[model samples]
Target: MLGILGLDELTERVYRELIHLGPSSVEALALRLSLDRDRVHRSVQMLEAKALASRNAVGQVQTAPPQLALGALLTAQRHALGQAELTAAALAEAYHSASTRSMHDLVEVAVGADQVRQRFEHIQLSAETELLALVQSTPEVVEPGQSFAEEEAVRRGVHYRVVIERPMLEEPGAMESVLGEVLGPERIRVVESVSTRVLIADRGTVMLPLTESPQVAEREGRRLDEVGEPMALVSRAPGLVTAMLGLFEYVWQRAVPVRLADDGLDAASADSAPTTLDLRILSLLLVGSTDAAIAKQLGLGLRTVQRRVAHMMELAGVTTRLQLGWQAHERGWLS
Candidate 1:
């Protein structure tokens, strides 16, 4: 029980023997503890230093009162703890400094769904400025009741911009729920396809899948989904994060804006008339500009260009890009 007071095993045993024997000599303690006399003498000297024991002028050892000795030990322990706390703080600062100096060291791999989710939640909670993501068709990462953290982040004025695959948004009531509870429709977009999943925060950190290729899975005679456990790579390298931000910008530009009914665009009017962005996209399309070229010409994102084109095609009741171009000309939309 008193080991917490910095007493070693032998010291505690000798101290206990001293208390039990009451003013016993080192020889008596050694005999009682079945320890060597020299070892008991050393323990007695240590106890004396702690003010727990004293040697009389006749050379016999005497123990201080239990209250006095225990109190002194407690005081010593508190002082040691204060010193340890200061040392720990200094060490933590040094470690943080060293970590900042090495960007490569900031990259980490998390395995298993739970670990990935935990890392994702940590990043979401820590985000202060902006969060950008491209979500593909994957297993759901956010479990029920866990979205409160994201809601808190949004309440703190953190901007969230997400581009989701169109098919994922097509789930029953998913779009409405996301718009109403998670993020506004203006900050979200949908794309026909996404190559990979990605998440970026404040242009400083990124998380992406760490998966094996189909060839490897085939060689192992395993289906893609059952090949191995899921993993994610998280990195805080400035250069790598910057490149990811560029990719997100390219995809965001080409994605179609998801306007809700309350945003002032009725289905009837949307089917008949084009939005300003849609008109710009039509003008670019009429000039024979590819999606990438249109995005570059108008300083829009590639995904935005593609999304507007798709929206225009839907409005014109055309099934193909070429047919939409012909419809635009026939309806005097090109003029």
Candidate 2:
């Protein structure tokens, strides 16, 4: 209907009369449509505003070509409708994806420090069964005890597992405080190095940096903190969670246990134990150091290094080096 194009009945009739009569005076148009002259003049003015009609010097209104005028309006509206259709379809796709809990909701980006901090706390507080951490910083620097919510998470019987890299081990008192006080030594492990920081809760949700490390970014000549605040991503997608958990497991299995309490008892080593020198020797061995290399590093005789290793194996009741490594880890002797 022409009404859909912003023309009411009287305005449309006046336009139609102009088209039919070629050109007509306002008074004649009003007489023919049975309308007052003033109303007809207003309709003609509206038609002129819409470019559907105009007056010549003689003051008679003439219609523009219908195809050029109304056709253009129709074409513009069709274009607008097409754009609206695309928007609607996209919204519907998002709605359906959300309703099904599909992979479309894979990564939720948290930009800026406040958002990243909130996500970090959310993952820790929302954990139901287990909390796994991959920390590159000192254990105490990451989160310490009297560990407020961390203690609360522990109280809820949430299993906490932490793996720290060598950089963390280099920190003073890195192992004696924080998680040590809250979770004990058995919950902690250490590896030669960890690629990045990750916090996973119940293998269900993960919070991690949005991009790779600055070292990685530097290869492309971009700084990670160029935008001032770091960004983090939280994912609840099942596949992503499983993949992240797999990565954690891969790192955890190879990590040796930390000695949280300097005086803690080791059932395997209680009678004749590995001393500070012995633990250092074991730490070197875990990094693939030979007996000769271990002796040189620790200023001990090669025989002394070999004897300490052999004695440790005997204390662990293990016959092979591999089994001894496992047993030493179980007894929490390595760094």
> Which model scores highest in TM-score?
2
Cα lDDT of all candidates, in order? 0.74, 0.74
| Candidate 2 lDDT by residue in tens digits, 82-136 | 9999999999999987876654366788876667666777677788888998876
Residue 89 shift from truth in candidate 2, angstroms: 8.2
Global CA lDDT computed for model 1: 0.74
Candidate 1 TM-score over all chains jointly:
0.47
List TM-scores for all candidates, in order. 0.47, 0.53
Query: Over the stretch 1-335, how does candidate 1's per-residue lDDT look in tens digits?
Result: 76787678999889888788778878888888899999888888888988899988888888899897888779888999999999999999999988866755779988877888888888889999888988764434553224666777788888988877655543334434554555642276667767777889888999987874344567689886775766889998888898899999999887755533334443235655786557655654653457776676556678877877888888889999889877876876634
Model 1 steric clash total: 9
Off by over 4 Å in 1: 1-105, 143-146, 178-180, 212-226, 261-335
Residue 12 accuracy (lDDT) in model 1: 86
- Candidate 1 backbone collisions, by pair: 253-301, 253-303, 253-304, 254-301, 254-302, 254-303, 254-304, 255-303, 255-304
Which portions of model 2 show Cα errors greater than 4 Å? 1-106, 138-147, 212-228, 261-269, 272-335
Model 2 poorest 10 in a row by lDDT: 138-147
